[model samples]
Target: MLKWLRRSEPKEVPAATLGPLQIVKPWARSSASEPDVGGGYMTVVNDGESDRLVSASCSAAGSVEIHAIRVKGPALEMRKQDAGLVIPPANQQILKPRGYHLLMRDLASPLLAGSKVPVTLVFEKAGSVTVDFAVEEPGAVGHVTLRSS
Candidate 1:
């Protein structure tokens, strides 16, 4: 006598529906013994076929502003970017310290190391993506540790 065995088809896992919005290398300033000025950094990649990234906001600090750090006459100056940052198609923009970054002012609480900071990023085209920034030691070298959702 012979027996027959049957196999079932494998189910497919759906892809992420949040199209084209990619976040990379996101990091927040390390916790300081005293509450001082700090900022956040990240890179936004827009892989979509069109332009995106109209604005960005966060609740981690009293107010989040998009600013640019420029070297003006041997002095570093941060200026508000009123027009907002833009992430063009297939391009990327960086938000790093002493440069284009998220100005986190009036920190509500101390960002302890080995902890996480909740940050919600809002985009005009891609909607919103929330991420937790890992806290590290102050004065640590910049590294790529965060990614987009």
Candidate 2:
């Protein structure tokens, strides 16, 4: 294949770290039928102190919110985390599917596979960090691991 024709690997963006907090393995699900909605996932590791994930934002969407899925009955419900997600000290907070994830609504455009979305996560103590979330297959169960060079 021609070098120019081959798709270039996305550059690795440094994790947002402040004090003891580090955001890692950020990724998102590709938008399918519902072009206006999508999900973002990541792991927030706190090695030193506890922190709070206050909010999030994405330029591709009108709003980005921290959310959790709950079993209300036979059906599942998604509830927004108004108070934000807490990152325990010496532990990690995982934002994944069917659990804690970022809910993106009013998307400017559908998120296609192989594309990327930039999300700004605001923390109470660690401040904020913008992560480039790789968009994976629409029905992807987990994040796509980027191979190290």
Candidate 3:
């Protein structure tokens, strides 16, 4: 005997559609003097659902952590985001200067301008995404020396 057709059927999500996260305008500030620390900026957009950015890693640098700036009295201060960065559904997380950004400490070498810095971002839902950050001038702002065009 053959089975009858069902009234409704469940659908399975595709693997390609699982990765609905995107990274835009990834950039890192260049250090001319081979400083002990470096910084990077980017925008993480989640078009599907909520996710948590657990951690980050870079082979070129010693350590990687999420950082944010806070104004304390008459001065501004920078600190690590111990809880990690979270990405809400249909929302975007920004990583910029004087805000929620990334900290690259104990650099192996100076981040030269017009170069690329490869970093891997680990997400709880989306897994890991490896993106390259364009190196900009030491004191420059915006996406001036973007090489990942």
Quote model 2's TM-score. Answer: 0.80
Better of 1 and 2 by TM-score: 2
The lDDT values for all models are 0.64, 0.81, 0.75
Model 3: per-residue Cα lDDT at residue 86: 88
Off by over 4 Å in 2: 1-14, 72-74, 140-149
RMSD to the hidden true structure, all candidates: 10.1, 11.3, 11.4
Q: How well does candidate 2 score on lDDT at residue 3?
A: 62
Global lDDT of model 3: 0.75
Best candidate per lDDT, number? 2
lDDT of 2 by residue, 72-107 (tens): 445556778889999999998999876889989898
Q: Write the residue-wise lDDT of candidate 3 on 49-74 in tens digits.
A: 89988889998889998877765565
TM-score-wise, the better of 2 and 3 is 2
State the local distance difference test value for candidate 1: 0.64
**Model 1 spans > 4 angstroms off:** 1-18, 30-36, 50-54, 140-149
